[model samples]
Target chain A: MSITAILINAFALVCLIYGFYRDRDKAVKSLKKAAKSLFGILPTILIIIIIIGLMLGFVPPAEISRFVGEQSGILGVLLVGAVGAVLHIPALIAFPLAASMLESGATVMAVAAFITTLTMIGIVTLPMEIKILGKKFALLRNGLSFIIAIIIAILIGVIL
Target chain B: MLLAGMFIVALILVSIYPDRRGAVFNTSMDYLTEMAFILPAVMVLMGLFSVYIPEETVVKHLGKASGSKGFFLAILFGTLPTGPLYVAFPMASTLIKKGARISNIVVFLSAWACIKIPQEMVELQFLGPEFMLARLSLTIIFVGLMGFVIEWMMKRTNGVIDG
Candidate 1:
């Protein structure tokens, strides 16, 4: 692990330990809750990540690269950004994936738009986010994020 | 044992509900396969995050005083952070407890989820520098704007959670 990673882990450990030491009962309750939730969902989440990785490994980055490589100005930027908004991909995966697309000849503007939307717009996670943060907040945040992402994409398209 | 129970439930549901059960089963199977690939790395990260960083530390650096510039810094800091989105939600809750602004938390989580630069660098090795830089710049701007928008919306709606 990197030094950063080690530091982070140490930090988390201290917090958790502090919490437990400060209030044993509360700590126990919280830990139990965490375990239940983790046990129930960790496997599911883990399985999903692996499946995504496999699909990514198998799919030809060239295909995605070609589609996103079109630099038709504003229209291309919007199209690419919109596509990113609709599809949810992990950010870690998205970067490498975006990079591969770029290597395969994808346009910078399209890739930027795609990454912006991928992180900002939570189309797939919309239901979950709305459930947790409420409809109004979720809608406002996501809509604003998408608009901002588009603007940024345009700026990058022009500036870089 | 859990697997057996799941299989039994699947059998019963399929017999009674047919299409619904079949679709659910298929989806679960697909999800399981996907998790298998990403789990180990995610697990290691989780273990590290839990064992390493003190919440107080993340809160100290990421607290709202971190401002617009702080907001940008938090987003970048968050991007490299390795954890599930849900993990951040509770951490955000805690940060709120520690006097962090809701807007900042939202920006951190949003950027953490979206604009990871280091990860982007790895992709850069494969995708090309121009594309990664473009994506990173756009994402940073979006995340910063998101913080302001969220702040505005929360104020108007009176949605700020009392920490």
Candidate 2:
């Protein structure tokens, strides 16, 4: 367990003690509600993440690197950003893939786009977010993320 | 198209016989464990917030036009935060449950996921100082802008969960 987990555990214990002493019924009910909400969604998120991982495993690095390496400037940045929007690889997975791509001569702009979108945008999570937060909010948030991700990439490209 | 069709069928099947299938059953268990561990803590945090962190503190730090300073602060706080996104989801849910404004939770989450400073430091070792700095600047700008947009949209819809 991480320090975070330990801290959370300690804090939870204190809360539990406080709640149990103060209002047992409310404490128990709140915990149950929290558990129910977490359980309800975890399965779907896990399945989706696993599916994404499997799909990512199939793509060839050379193809991705070549495209990113193209000297098409603004278009290349935009394309990379679009790709980032659609993909949701975690940072752990993305780093290694990016390292290899960099080794293979992909441009910094492309990798920046990928990393930004990989964290910021969520094309795969769109359906889930839409269901949870409603369509308009989810779309607006994601749409903005997509645009900002590109701008971020280009900014990184110029500054770095 | 084929994948989409298959996913739709799968969703239907899960909804109908959610527990009958082994994969779905196991998945549900994972979800249960995740929630069991996280939710209580989130509620306590909410309760703690009610007790501790002043509303003025949140408002002053998290306000829409707080600019880069607020954004940087948000990122620093966000980076130190550790929990599943679900933890934030529920806290945000419960904060809205307890009359916290939509903008607060929205900004909290946007910054929570985006500007994790510690995570960025680790990332910097690999991505380089220049890339890390640039990403940081951009994320702060983007999340700050997002907070304003979320607030505006909430007002327009008048359907924010907050009361």
Q: Among these predicted structures, which one has the highest TM-score?
A: 1
Could you tell me the TM-score of candidate 2?
A: 0.55
Candidate 1: where is the Cα deviation over 4 Å? A1-67, A103-105, B1-50, B54-56, B59-73, B97-99, B159-163
On the 0 to 100 scale, the lDDT of residue A134 in model 2 is 59
DockQ of each: 0.14, 0.15
| Tens-place lDDT digits, model 2, residues A1-160 | 3344355557667866786787677666656654664455444445543333222333344565557775566777778778777876544335434544564567787888777677666778777666666566667777877777777777777787
Which prediction has the highest DockQ against the true structure? 2
| lDDT tens digits by residue: candidate 1, B95-153 | 76667766777787776666544344334443455655666665666666677777777
Cα-lDDT of candidate 2: 0.57
